[model samples]
Target chain A: MDALTGAWQWLTTAANWAGDKGVWHRLAEHVQISAVCLVLSCLIALPVALWLGHIGKGGALAVNLSNIGRAVPTFAVLVLLTLGPLGSQGEWPTVIALVLFAIPPLLTNAYLGIREADRDAVEAARGMGMSGPQLLLRVELPLAYPLLMTGLRSAAVQIVATATLAAMAGGGGLGRVITAGFGNYDTAQVVAGAVLVAALALAVEGVMVAVDRLCDPMRGRRRAARIGRGPGERRGARDDDAVAIGGAA
Target chain B: MSVPWSLTAAAWPSGQVPADPGGPWLPQAAAPGGADCLVANDWICGAYLRTRSHELLAATVQHLGITAASVALGLLIAFPLALLARRRRAVAGAVLGLTTVLYTIPSLAMFALLTPVFGVSVAVVITGLVLYSLTILVRNILAGLDAVPAEVREAARGMGYGPARMLFGVELPLALPAVVAGIRIATVSTVAMTTIGSVVGFGGLGNLIASGLQGFFKAEVLTASVLCVLLAVAADLLLMAVQRMLTPWTRPRAGSRSGGRRTRATKAVA
Candidate 1:
């Protein structure tokens, strides 16, 4: 399509990739803002969720509360913060709103991940003289890795995509380019910005998947040890799990 | 507190109208100098209603209309996709994967991408939102189909129930809770995402928030923000009530501790 070509041309312009308005600079800004929000979200949400999940108490309430938070629409929250008292705090309003936006999934999945770890492995760990923290660190967290990573992946993808809200608050990111394109009525530039954000989101997902696979403590061993199941039932379960991943997505 | 404690409380003379929190207790302070409106409290109440209520009402209707149409369209599309996906795991994976990519596209980007083709109409907003609602709705529908227990299917077949009859009478009834849960999630999330439509000047309550923000009218911003949250929460609860009313068959099955928790967790995460 001519539109695609125009978008490509817009993206290909070297001038578009330089200066404060450059795609690269905005990309960096986007990543920085998302990374900060993600890390801070993980930091704030994970501990409380994992603790509750570990203790097997209050997980439902915490997840529900965060779900309420999630429904509060990040754009609304960001607008209020930016236009209110914190308006002059530069990027903090965006950061804080994003961190809040990312919390529900992080909390829900982390708690669910921990609480849903194999009961046998947990009992075995406890029977083996593993203390609370040790079991959580060694057995629980590692076993919970896939779901946790899924949560992280979900949160990370969302943050990367929505980080453009930074522009609304007078901060800088890839969103700025799109806003500028809109103001100028340049459809090509707008489409180009979309392409950039989409590419960034997909890239983040690819990297997260690799990291999830690589860091999984029980990856190859679990599959190998379960090989005696004659493959049929095992395959069904693996497929079911893939469906679970779909359900989460 | 003006709690509506009894189901029939509204029938009582004193309780007929109920109390409003927006009554005398709310902030009555005037706007700071250089703000958009005359007095802040006036914007919060009298003046905001007197001048801006009509516009607010229009935007709210637009917002509601866009959300309703998007989700309804999404449901219509997702149903067939879910059915096809149910036939094969590979199909399910591929379909779900495609929708996931759609979901991952930023709301802003989605709007921008649509602008070239649809030119800022309701079609643009609706299409983008339908794409978003699909992943969850399709996934949930498929999950519901998959969850129909094997023995139930076997028993239905043993009773001479044909494939179509079994699907409709047995599996569908069984799957209603999950399906309804999915709808609830989709609707609530759609309502929230609809606010982003204001970026291009078409979102309902979102228009108010955008205009208020640009104009530095705190009361307008506050009211719109709270209304958006209320809309989402109310939609969620209303759908949940509908699910409860329609799917009596699924309730006892959800009696176990783990079953309820799993449902809650799934709804929360999704």
Candidate 2:
């Protein structure tokens, strides 16, 4: 009973604190870190992904490297880099770490999207006397844009969420408030920080979803429907088609 | 070509001895060697080993345990939810969207939020980790399940198989590849994110890195970072092996084009 009361008081206090100017500063810092990390990662990853997709070479290596990046915990990487000769113990290390963390999705999607562009369409463009660069820019890029965008969306969300780890290294963000709360045994602060993060993430995701809809209006309806139908229903439907096709083939 | 005497001397008159003192004549510092070097190396190594093992062990166990538990919980929740969601498209979409939103919440913030409520316990850590995994698991499981053939389901139904039997006997086996792919992704993610749990004093590999940063212990930090990369690679390989073993049917058989054709068909359907 006492513990519950204590938790309730803490929650109320933290909620009040959240409305203060400091909390807004922390939120701004968090958003800035996330944005910088996302943009930097996309810039680095997108070109490489496009090049790899165009050449159809080094994709396996790039993908595996990205996977390795995904596997290595960002927090560990931040700590390691910060302690190294880089001496980057602030937002920079956090940004670098998040950039590394964000690369795989962007790279994978861009590579896959371009590589998997309709070959027939490329052939048709070639028949029309399109040059290599022309074909890529005119045909391949447009087709790959949607997938690339998807990767960026995922990266954005991931960076926003992971940016909090920056706080643990004595950097500033909503994480700072949460950590302070934890240290002070203030449950309300912790809850408030978390709620803010959750709200922030959802808002970001909503924006991305809206962006996805605007960018690929044709896919908007189908995409939601498809994503909603558990992979099984889709698979079952596909397998049936496969068996039929296999028999025919 | 009347050059100044200082310039000529400094430039070294062709084929003549230069008055300049700067040449190979400047002796480089001798590299440290023998017992002094060995003793320094030993001291460094000793210092590292002494200060490192406790942090390393604590971090490793915490990471491995939390990741394992989170992935397991995620799978437990995701599989059934996926199954249920498959039947109801609206419900499945909502669940997936919810989880996706949950997944986007930054880990640090989530931990911060959870800390107050759960107070830095293993429960808080696992809950956060599991929530992260839910989105990926649900998506993958659904994808895997969707990969199953309708005919197979119909045939099973024709043979009087119930929904449970059809799922287990036909849909699951066929969808194993996609489902396993999802698991592989979830596992990799869980392993990486488990480090975030360290913020709550759960003591994972992230702790090692954190301490290294605070104390300026480069060796410890490097050791921890390398271990994490290696762990992720090892886990990926392990899961790949497991996926292969579990779904022998998906494997391309020797001297058969059936697998290729099936793959194309699956792609078309997808």
Candidate 3:
């Protein structure tokens, strides 16, 4: 109980510190880094994903490359780039690193979403004399929008979280508060920063959920119906559908 | 011919053209100067190898061991929670929402948060890594379980299978492919994030790269970066192989368009 009280007290103090003007500046810097990185990653990845999805070639290679990008740690990449001729030691290097980190999900999800578009719908469009780009713009992209939005949402959250590493490199953000809290053994400050980040993430997720619902209005109805059904009934319905599909085929 | 040679040389002018068109160029002449440093740094070369090889090996082992342990724990916790959350849409949404938020917390901040209480050791590092893996792993597992055909579970129940038995025999097996795919994603992510352990002063290859950058040691930085990329590639390949091994039951049989169609349909639904 005493330890819990102490922790609470520490948290309060930290929150106070976080509210300081200097800390807010740092937080703003971090948000800027995350936003820039997210935009840059989307710009780089979306076009490539769209192109790959459209062509339906080099997808495996593009996905594998993006996976490799994810595997490479942001810190290590930042450190390497900062030590090289491009040796930017500040926010730019961190931005570049976060951009690399953010690319895979955006690229993969977008590519997968488009590639997984309803083939029959696409065929129907083509049969009506739609050109390749025309079919993509008029038919495929609209249907793929919800999944694409999910990818963007994922990318946004990831970049925001990752942007904090910039603090280690002396780039500013909410991470500086966390890092400083650690250095000073200020538990409250650490907790405050962590809580803020968590809250921010939740806010972003809520926004995304809303966006997802907006993109797919039918999802809500289907989800609600699934929920209202008893487990056994739900299972029966799914099984029946599968059996029907199998029989038809 | 002798008289012609003198005339050709005189006409060309020494500054305007080289005596031989195919002669080694100025840059070639400067190559030896570059090689001199490398030749003189032989002892440093050996020293570099001795120090780096030991550190690299130690870091690699520690990283792999920690990552594997965390991933295993993450899988164990996530799978059951996912299963329980399957029918409870509200609970699942909340869990998914929480995990997604958790997933987005900067690893560095999480480590920093842990360090004050845990004080910068292996325990804190492992805890952070495990937490990071849980979000994605749980989401994937739940999604996989949710994806199992309703008829399969109904069929199992009709066969007098209890909930536990049905889950183990029917739902889990069917969901294995998606679960493994999630695990693959989690494993690769955990491997990468383990590099952040460097901030706590626990040595990983990241530490080498960090120090190399701080001290302007180009060779060390290059070596660390190259090794990290190699490790990531190797980890991805290993996880892919493991995914294939574990989900052999889910593997497509010969000439079955069914497998492709099912995958496409599920993707559309998602």
Model 1 DockQ vs. reference:
0.39
Which candidate ranks first by DockQ, i.e. highest?
Answer: 1
Better candidate number, 2 or 3, judged by lDDT: 2
Q: What is the RMSD of candidate 2?
A: 16.1
Ranking by DockQ: 1, 2, 3
TM-score of 2: 0.78
- Please name the candidate that would achieve the greatest lDDT relative to the true structure: 1
Q: Per-residue alpha-carbon lDDT of model 1 for B118-222, expressed as tens digits?
A: 775567778888999898899788777877767667767777878788777777777888898788778887888888776566666776776677667677777
Candidate 1 chain B lowest-lDDT run of ten:
B9-18
TM-score of each: 0.85, 0.78, 0.74
Binned by DockQ into CAPRI classes (incorrect, acceptable, medium, high), candidate 1 is acceptable
* Global lDDT scores for all candidate models: 0.74, 0.66, 0.64
Deviation in Å, model 1, residue B60 alpha carbon: 1.2
Docking class of 3: acceptable
Tens-place lDDT digits, model 3, residues A109-128:
67866787779989999999
For model 2, the superposed segments whose C-alpha errors exceed 4 Å read: A1-21, A88-90, A215-249, B1-47, B50-55, B257-270
TM-score of 1: 0.85
Which of candidates 1 and 2 reaches a greater TM-score? 1
lDDT of 2 at A8: 55
Off by over 4 Å in 3: A1-21, A88-90, A127-133, A204-249, B1-47, B87-90, B146-160, B246-270
